[model samples]
Target: MHDKTAAPENQHLSHRTAWLRAAVLGANDGLISTASLVVGVISAGGDAVLAGIAGVVGGAMSMAAGEYVSVSSQADTEKADIELERQHLANNPEYEVEELAQIYRERGLTQELSHQVAEQLMAHDALAAHTRDELGITDQLQARPTLAALSSFFAFLFGAVWPLLAAWLNVTFLFPHPLITIAVGTAIMLILLGGLAAKMGGASVTHGAIRVCLWGLLAMLATALTGRLFALVVG
Candidate 1:
């Protein structure tokens, strides 16, 4: 027996998936990329705070622009698809209706029942019914270019702040060296960011945190090695 009294919460998770993905990905990129840049510069015997600042600002702006362009392109494609669907409905409504009803039938409704359901839905909102069922597009999940871009921009900025601040703190002064401090701070941010992202996505926090931290470790290590190599060449 289904408890109709239960709240239909989180139904919009799929709708939110787009923005959530953009935000989390942008922030994660910002954190890892900037932190790596700072560590790389330091390993190469450059100033830590200066390099970190440059990396943070550059990374944030780059992330914002990239997110804007990407989301805008997506929005354009979705808009074109919707327009085409509209035209198809105008030109071949009966065929479209049959298509929609068949989709419902395939979902286990009786043929007559499918037809009735489609008929009623189409009569009430033909375009909506067709777009949602046939094209798998819903108003709730419609692409919002501006929203995505803005979200990414700010999230990236937020992520970039952690590493930049950590680098500025000269935590290595308290530790063995700058590398240790920077790496430790970055690692903490990575794990925290990963867990936060996972929680938002309703996934396993440990898995998410571990996965992201591992990647961060590899990224930092690679940067450290590259910086050391470059330093030797320059030295």
Candidate 2:
């Protein structure tokens, strides 16, 4: 009797690279940008809630649009490569087979085995085998523009909402030093977001947290100075 137990599937992070990148970038930018906007407005003695609201909305839309356009471009390139490969396979079947076999040879397979494997694979599905092996295109890593755009939009909105909420709470309770509260809250969120991103990417959580915090601090500082200068110039 043959054992029919299923093999365990490996969970590789490469498959998540496309969407993960968009989500992380969107969230990080939204948090820092919105927080910076609120900080700058507060530093200029303006209404924090109003600035936070505007920044959150505008930032989320911008992130979504940017992600969609960029990912669409990547998808286009992939499509073009696939079409070109199809043409090559149609034009010269023998050369394409040799090319695929050469790829296998370079990857450590013996010449005899490589050619055999290539021939068998081509017989089964020539385009798929070539696209995957020669062109490095796989269904797992295909770029989906709509998915990326939605991920970015939601992530940005989620990140921006935190700072907005923090500002609103500060104002509602009449905090004497609202800037401190907003800044601290934003920094905490940034650290947490960084850790979460790093965890998903299989990297050091502490390093990611520290790195994002530093950048967030610098962005807020720059914006605060700009607001101060603007206030000084106008008022």
Best by TM-score: 2
Tens-place lDDT digits, model 2, residues 2-84? 55686456567655664675577678888999989998998888998998998888888888898889989999999999999
lDDT of each: 0.83, 0.88
Model 1 Cα lDDT, one tens digit per residue, 129-234: 8878988888777777777667777888888888788777774444457788778888888898899788777789999999999999899899999999999999
Measured with C-alpha atoms, the lDDT of residue 27 in candidate 1 is 85
State TM-scores per candidate: 0.87, 0.89
- Where is model 2 more than 4 Å wrong at Cα? 1-18
Model 2 compared with the native: what TM-score? 0.89
Clashing pairs in 2: none
